[model samples]
Target: MKNIGQRLLEERRRLGYSQQYLARAGGVSAHEQRQYEQGEDLPRADYLAQLAAHGVDVVYVVTGKRSTVINISRDQAQTLMDNRVVGQEVTLDGPPEEDLYFKLSDPSGPPPDQS
Candidate 1:
């Protein structure tokens, strides 16, 4: 299995960010970022959260597990369909009947009475 540092490096490279850029974004020094990529050190929780905000897959970087939730805006989804990036058409309205990678809970309890 790959180490967390290796995963962090991969994610940084995937985003085309330099060590300095990533460090600045994560509110750390470039040296620290280098150390993280080299597996010499681990980032703090706040730094990890910063990385997530910058679109880094923090969960994958730490635990090597990809998140099941796939967040895409309606416009982005429409664009994917227009470009044939997705083969199947999807409706954003209502809960999906089938199981998906992530499940949405009914947060409001139950619907109001029709009567």
Candidate 2:
């Protein structure tokens, strides 16, 4: 399993962010960012929260597993798949729009046959 620093570094690279840029965005110094990426230091809660606000999956960075919750109806699921967006912003509280909600909720099988 990758260490937390490795995961953070990978995520930053995946987003095409330089350590300096990520540090600025996360409100940390570039040296601090390097330390975090090198596993010489761990980020504080505020820094992690800042990263999350900038679209970093801090949970995955820390745990090496992405956290996901699925619970949509069939129709909603189909709609979600049909209109899938790569980096769409998702609201997690209430039910999603019909399509997005379904996709997130249901994991039954292939989408219904469309003839």
Candidate 3:
């Protein structure tokens, strides 16, 4: 398992962020950011929250496990963020929009087959 600092550094590199930039966004000094990335110091909860707002997956940084964060939006990638997916389970919330016209109007894809 990677250390928190290693994971933090990995995330930072993945986003192409400099320590100075991330530190400013997290309300910390660049030196502090180095310490956090070097495993010399642990970041505060508030600092972590700030990093999250700046696109850092703090959950993954701390726990080495990514959180169930889904972008529930009308515009995104080709994959549809269906409401039926809750956490790790696929749930049936309702009849699932049976309107063929609605499906045709949707850009995600065609409606699921009833058969």
Off by over 4 Å in 2: 69-115
For residues 1-115, what per-residue lDDT tens digits would candidate 1 score against the true structure?
Answer: 8999999999999999999999999999999999999999988999999998788988899999865566665666556556765567655554444333333446787788999
What tens-digit string does per-residue lDDT give for candidate 2 at 8-58? 999999889999999999999999999999999988889988998677888
Question: Against the correct fold, how does model 2 do in TM-score?
Answer: 0.61
lDDT ranking of the models = 1, 2, 3
Clashes of 2: 5
Residue 66 error, candidate 3, Å: 1.4
TM-score of each candidate structure, all chains considered together: 0.64, 0.61, 0.64
Top of the candidates by lDDT: 1
CA lDDT, candidate 2, residue 46: 90
Task: Name model 1 segments beyond 4 Å from true.
Answer: 74-115
For all the candidates, what are their Cα RMSDs to the real structure? 10.5, 10.1, 11.8
